[model samples]
Target: MSDADAPLSATPRTRLRRMSQKGRGDRGALFEVLRAGLVCHLGALVDGCPMVVPTVYGFDTTHLFLHGSVASRSLTTDAEVCVTVTVVDGLVLARSVFEHGVNYRSAMVYGTPRRVVDAEEKLYGLRLLTEHVAPGQWDYTRAPNGRELAATALLALPLAEASVKTRSGPPDDGVGPDAALGLWAGELPLVATWQQPLTDPALPATVAVPAHVAARAGTRADRS
Candidate 1:
């Protein structure tokens, strides 16, 4: 994708195009790819130097919201941000080592991100952030105190400039003459699943695993 701040096509022209198979154009495709991921690579510039960092993000239908410690440089500045999220589901095992590949879903967004500053909106943004991780956990846990609230920064990136790339199924060369070589040639799928939760040693058994946490097993975000 071009580094220009404008939205790329639904499937941007990139080195990975061969694996990008989404049929829809624009927003539909981008949203689908984004929804399939839990973490995103957020890119921005600080003092003319390019910086790309991994971060957790949440989204409403029209925008993506990112939050971090108030001390985080990425959220503090009014930089034009580019966020990309990718989720890999399998390793393509081919007879030839040169043809190895991974099946994945990805989305990239470009824009001048706006930081959310209002207290009410920030609280709502926090809910979007937390609930996006575990649908019902926001209300069950302790709400942020004054100190915690003052230490968090949130930025919401619009869906205006975004695109998606996705890949599925088996390797293209899996059925070539290499197939007769007797070498294994198929997809080795990777899946993410939640394990049991660990509770704080000081907490009593009366503080049960909230339904939100209990329901998270097998969730896509639980990807290992």
Candidate 2:
């Protein structure tokens, strides 16, 4: 099978013990979850203690990129880390409170991240991060200078060890004993959309909003 069509490896850390049916093994399914998320929680060991920090990230077919200050504890090279991204689609309200659950798509990525030191790759990684957060902002804004690049840390973690799990549709109790209860049960869908652009107050009145920024208004923030 092609790499994109290959099933995810069931490694010790990535195997789903519970609700295994919800686990997605296809790489395409994994990419779908990542594409729909804008932020990821990065977990790492800092000074013998665990730390999980939410940060913006960008990913390609082989690697996920994250950037921060050079001295940031969480960006240490060769450190084993776990990165997770989740997108909540809705709330499944069941007949009983115990059966109520969330409809979500989540992925966990495990790897030892390496610091990006090559000037060219570092710049490209930064571009990926910027464009992931704001599509047209990279070309619209000034490029990072030597001093700026020196102070910033860029990390590239391989996507080889990753797992995706998704849950959707109604609650499982619908066909069970709870179905006899005279109670309403359904899904409360949740959607996130972009509002109209808020121009910076510091900008001159003569300046107009960029077409790329203005176009995002009223658009759905989550692709899935």
lDDT over C-alpha atoms for residue 217 of model 1? 65
List, residue by residue over 143-205, the lDDT tens digit for candidate 2. 999999999999999999999999999988888998999799999999998999888999999
User: TM-scores of the models, in the given order?
Assistant: 0.84, 0.97
Residue by residue across 1-224, what tens digits does model 1's lDDT show?
43233344543433245534553345665666666677888888867888888987888767788989878877744667889888888999888988888987777788888888888988888898777667787888799987888898888888776666677778778668887888778899888877777888999989888777877766656333
Best by TM-score: 2
List the global CA lDDT of all models: 0.75, 0.91
lDDT of 2: 0.91
Q: Estimate the TM-score for candidate 1.
A: 0.84
Worst 10 residues of 1 by lDDT: 2-11
Q: Which stretches of candidate 1 lie over 4 Å from their true place?
A: 1-26, 218-224
- For model 1, what is the alpha-carbon lDDT of residue 149? 86
